[model samples]
Target chain A: MPDSSMPAARASTLIVVPAYNEAATLGDVIRALRADWPWVVVIDDGSTDRTAAIGEAAGAEVVSHTVNRGQGAALQTGFRYGLDRGARQLVTFDADGQHSSADLERLLEPVVSGRVDVALGSRFLEVKSDIPVLRKMLLKSAVVFTRVTSGLRITDTHNGLRALSRAAVEQLDLRADRMAHASEILDQIASHRMRYIEVPVHVRYTRHSRAKGQNTLDAFRVLIDYLLARVFR
Target chain B: MNAFQILGISLSSCFAILVVLGVVRRRLRPLPGAAWAALWIAAAIAIAEPDLTVVVARALGIQRGADLIFYLAILGMFIGFFVMYVRMRHLDEGLTAVVRRLAIVEARHRIEETARGEHEASERSPTD
Candidate 1:
């Protein structure tokens, strides 16, 4: 449990959950996060369902977009909200319940201790995660792609679970506005020369999460978006 | 002049006049409007003297005027699409910014409201 006596401590760490039409799992996710972290903000990215209502009911501060921006846009909104509220550390957690609240403490350890600017969760670092075969193959391909493009040696390229220090958060300029933001983030990290670490984390790939996850064809779109951004930038 | 040449030249001339009128009325910006006018006038010239295209194509190492026109049309289309895509991306980024600002402001208001309600509720109740 976080120390509630020190309000500054609570204010320093913020959990940002970017939710899009995950009304079924958002409430539970927020509630679970609120157990350990008091400052939880949910970016309801134009969900047609009751995502915002559920998030608010679960005791999370909910900010809602009027239109359906992609997950990358939602994450950027959450980052801005956290920064505006004077948060020193921001953690991005998936709303689809694939990411566990338990791993958050470990994921945030390096950043909170001022050891590294970012902590990226990697399921491939350890063999504990039971990823589907096709998904695993796709993720491996993405890892190779990131390594070649960004020159960053990391096991996972598309993990949503990450902890960023204030400096890292302020330096990152996320413009992909879609799944391509994952690669974009890594590209920026490499270019900015921010110190980063990879922490082994377990990912629960349930039926619901799998359904919400990206398919094979999205890899190509993400590649195109990343390449176009590079070329234009 | 052939029938097709007369018809094409007339249509292109009408478009060039419209473009000029748009520029004079300030309905279009100077640079882009000038570009449109130049394009229409060039089309008129190409239609009036198809042999000119053949000469230009030969200078460019192309065999036929029709082939040159086809390649130029495709290239122009690609450039047009690229420009539109860049503009669309800028618009998307702007929209995202506006949406993000609204969401943050609304969330702040909601938080303040909740805090005020809690304070009022505490005041209405007896202190321990």
Candidate 2:
């Protein structure tokens, strides 16, 4: 548990974990987060399992969707909840235990210190993690796609680990209710001209995480969804 | 008229009448109802005078009347699909908003309940 005498800034920072049927790993993820962060909210995306129960048992606030609305909607719900509770900073972390709580402070530093409105985690920044060959290729391709489309020049386009200042939180309005929200966030960052930076973070691709993660084909679907959204909007 | 033309015209006329009745009874808006009626009427005319389409097709530089109808049908289907896709996307957004609001409200209630429980527990405890 986080010490009660922790600084107000750390205490006010809300870590939002968007989960869908993550009963196998949510408990450990929340427990690890709660050790350093006081405010941890798990958005259970209509998991028909023990996800919500595990989250509650792990001493984290659990917000549940009545039906599956995808990870994008779940994160938006978490953002609204954190904002309403007067959180000074919000961090989006995955529920698959791929993210490390130890790296969270570094990820939140720029946002908390008011140096940047958004801090994106990039696994490619330091090349510390043993990334799978195929997954690495996919992520690199996504980086190029994001650069061409949003002109952000980011190294990682879809890393779920990120920190947002309150101002950035209020400025972002996510309409993509699925994986495409990652691209949408970058698009908004470019359009809004919000200050942002990338922080090196390690991603653990466990068998469970890899199994739960997006397939190679899903990248095309996300691209189509993103392009169509741009065209339609 | 041929038997197929007679049947096609009869069906189109019935659908056009239904569309007009729908608008009159306030079941559909006037503009959409009018569009539906126009489509049915056009179908009836094409069925009644098949040679007219050949003339129109030639003026449009199309080879055959049947080819013209097929092309028009394909174009119309594409337009219909586009409209439906846009409408479905809007509906999805609306649903996401509703679900997000509900989740936030329920989480707030849960937070309040937990806080109340803790406060009561602390009040009942002896000072260290």
State residue B102's C-alpha deviation in candidate 2, in Å: 1.2
lDDT of 2 by residue, B67-99 (tens): 999999999999999999999999998998998
- Residue-level lDDT of model 1, residues B45-104, one tens digit each, is 998888999999999999999999999999999999999999998899899999999999
What are the chain B TM-scores of all models? 0.88, 0.91
Model 1 CA deviation exceeding 4 Å by range: A1-11, B2-4, B122-128
lDDT of each: 0.90, 0.91
Instruction: Report the number of the highest-lDDT candidate.
Output: 2
Candidate 2 pairs with clashing backbones: none
- Model 2, backbone clash pairs (residues 3+ apart or across chains), number: 0
lDDT (C-alpha) at residue B125 in model 1: 88
- Name the Cα RMSD for model 1: 2.4
TM-score quality measure for candidate 1: 0.93
Q: Total backbone clashes of model 1?
A: 0
* lDDT of candidate model 1 versus the reference: 0.90
